[model samples]
Target: MFLDRDGTMIDEVGYLDRREDVRWFPWTIDAVRLLNRAGYLVCVVTNQGGIGLGLFDEPFVHGLHAWLDATLHESGAVVDGWFLCPHHPRAVAAEMRGPCACRKPGRGMIDAACARWDIDLTRSWVVGDRDIDVMMAVAVGARGILVRTGHGERDLRKVDLSLPAGTPVVMDLMEATVLILAEGERRT
Candidate 1:
């Protein structure tokens, strides 16, 4: 499964730059563990425009991901890969940032992950706390689940109200894990 990091895995503090700012939700570790045991390659796809904006650099982002990996490892869950886009269209760093397909609401990172990991996008899932996450899932032909953690509830307010048939909204990551596993079983 593809997961968005900022709001889905940890608390949203608006442009997280420091490793000290990583704060995971209560059941997130368990939910990841569940996904791991279910044979899902849990991956993180995040937009780090702060890096492109000169607030931080790629090394700092990598360090934070390493720290997050350590934290999840301690809880017996291992993230398979991390794909981040550090570009924003407009700003002081806009000159430094160019348009890449990896940005959210786009399927660049998702497509790359599928190519690298041999993922079956049609059967995979994406979970995040934003409508853009849902859009990304649709873009990749994967299922989307918006969890009510971090900015989830706030992001939900921004959804287009009208959905195109199938979409999933769960209370949190734990419930999402349950739903994905159940659906996997049904598909099997």
Candidate 2:
């Protein structure tokens, strides 16, 4: 499974530049633990455009990920991999400017995860709180689940109206975890 970071796993704070702002939803740890126990490799794919926008540096991103790892570890949940895209189309940071394959709706990060983890798109899933997250999954022949958290309610309007009717939309990560596990059982 591929999960989006902000708005999906952790609470969405616009341009999260500090570790102090990290907020995990109440159900995040348990949901992740569930997936881990179920033999699913939980990978986090996030678009951290803040780096390119000069809001934060790459060190901040790595530091935040480290904090997240420790936090999740305390609860027995483990993320198998993390793929982040720091590039943005309109960036003040010269190095991070321009279009990149790793950004949301782009498959660069996802592709990297697949290569590193040997993930099979046919049996994988992408879970997030935005249309781009689901669209990324669909682009890669994987399942997509949109959760209603953070910008989710707003994105919900678009997802419900725009995404294929078959796409699954849930209340949060906990709900999404249940759905994914159930779907796996059904496939068996």
Candidate 3:
């Protein structure tokens, strides 16, 4: 499964830079463990414009990720990998200052993960808290689930009309995981 990090795993702290500021969402570890047990890769795909906008550097992002990983490990949930797009069209960085395909609403990161991990996109899932996450899943032929955490509840109104009819929107990660697992069991 591909998951969005900010707003999805951690609270939406508006481009969080410091490890001290990391506020992980409730039930994150248990939800991740459930997906992992269900044979999902549990990778993270996130957009960090703060890096490209000079609000924070790549090292800061990495440091925060490292801290997150360590914390998850302590809780018996491990993230498989993280794919981030640091570019923003309006605000560019000196090095990261260009249009890149790794951003969400684009399928570069998802495609790259599929290639590297031999993921079956058609059978995989994307869980996020934004419309961009839905667009990413649509681009890659995966199922997109919007969780009402972070910015999701607020962003729901902005969702487009093209999503599959009756696509489920859950309250949080744990509930989403339960639904996904139940659906998987039904299919079997």
Per-prediction TM-score to the true structure, in the order listed: 0.93, 0.96, 0.93
lDDT at residue 98 of model 2 (Cα atoms): 58
Per TM-score, the best of the predicted structures is 2
Please write out the lDDT profile of model 3 over residues 1-188, one tens digit for every residue.
89899888888888787777778887899999888888889889999888888888888888778888889999889788888888876666455766678888899888878777888888888898887888798889988998889988988776454556666788987888998899889989
Decide which is better by lDDT, 1 or 2.
Answer: 2
Each model's lDDT: 0.85, 0.89, 0.84
Model 1, residue 155: what's the lDDT?
68
Local accuracy of candidate 1 as per-residue lDDT tens digits, 55-100:
8988999988998899899989989999998887764765657777
lDDT of 1 at 25: 84
Could you tell me the C-alpha RMSD of candidate 3 in Å?
A: 1.7
**Candidate 2 vs 3: which has more lDDT:** 2
Better of 1 and 3 by lDDT: 1
Taking the tens digit of each residue's C-alpha lDDT, what string does model 2 give over 25-53?
A: 99999999999999999999999888888
Residue 139 displacement (Å), model 3: 0.4
Which stretches of candidate 1 lie above 4 Å from their native place? 159-163
User: In model 2, which regions exceed 4 Å deviation?
Assistant: 159-161
In model 1, pairs of residues that clash are none
- Using TM-score as the yardstick, the better of models 1 and 2 is 2
Clash pairs, model 2 backbone: none
lDDT of 1: 0.85
lDDT of 3 at 61: 82
